[model samples]
Target: MTKGEQTRRFIIKQSAELFNQHGYAGSSLSDITLATGIKKGGLYRHFASKDEIAVEAFNYACQIVGGKIEEAVQKGETSYDKLMAYFRVYEHAAESPPFIGGCPLLNTAVESDDSHPLLRSKAQESSGRTLDGIREIVEQGRASGEFRADVNAEALAMLTLSLLEGGIMLSRLEGSNRPMQLNIESYSSYLKQFCLK
Candidate 1:
């Protein structure tokens, strides 16, 4: 990559955690410069404004979390296992998240809601992708006769996402993993209910 491209990525890498932890409105230009060791002019050279940087930074944060989830899901032997593995990622992340902050999607969703339109949309899209992934796994399981036909894939997917994200929030706030582990166990039990007997 050219120097410009490298610098842009460096800014994103350094600012991702800042943006995720601080939110779009909370993070300032100074924070970006401080984190990246790049001046305001340099940041402006790469990003048009804080809004632009925030959108990109949020994408980077999501990529970090998504990569781990994809890895876990791929390692599963069955659809049910894959769905469970997805939650396991969050459980582990409660202890050691990909970045300093917890789930970026959750962070951005709460921060951007009715605040930053661009960021709010990005967070929404990220959530849709997550739900889509879960639904896909459920559909696969149903096709393979591993899950019951009566199961509502979309609803289950949304429930899984909500529980995982909510669990992360509670765990982070409480400074304990018990809440996260409990959420995972609860979801696992729920998943089993739909498993073919």
Candidate 2:
């Protein structure tokens, strides 16, 4: 890549964790500059405004979380296993998140809900992608006779999404991994009862 492209990536890499941890309003230009070791002029050169940088940073954060889920899904041998693996990412979130903060999708969704329209939309799309991933796994499991044919893939996917994200939010709020760990175990149990023979 060109030097300019590399620099832009470097800026995003440096600023992603800051944004994820601080939220859009909380993370100031000074924080970004300090994290990136770039001056205000240099930041403006790469990004037109803080909003622009925030959008990119949010995307970067989401990509990090997505990468972990994707990695887990790839390691599973069956559709049921893959779905469980996806949820397992959250179980391990406190110990090994893709970034410093918790789930970026959840963080961005809550922080951007009323403040940044573009970011809110981005979070919505990210959520939709997550739901789609769960639905696909459920559908695949049913097709393979691993999950019950009577199960509603979309409904189950939505339920799984709610449980996992809610659990993560609670865990982060309470500053304990117990909530998420319980959710993971309960989710796995539900999966075994709902899908596996």
- Measured by TM-score, the strongest candidate is 1
Among these predictions, the greatest lDDT belongs to 1
Give candidate 2 regions above 4 Å deviation.
none
lDDT of 1 at 118: 85
Can you write out model 1's per-residue Cα lDDT over 1-197, one digit (the tens) per residue? 99999999999988898987777788899988999999999888888988888888888888988998999999999998898887788775556876668899999999989988888899889999999999999999999989998888989898888898888889888888888899988887887865654
User: Please, what is the whole-model Cα lDDT of each candidate in the order they appear?
Assistant: 0.87, 0.85
Worst 10 residues of 2 by lDDT: 90-99
Q: Each model's TM-score, in the order given? A: 0.96, 0.95
Span of 10 residues, lowest total lDDT, candidate 1: 91-100
Error of 2 at 20 (Å): 0.5
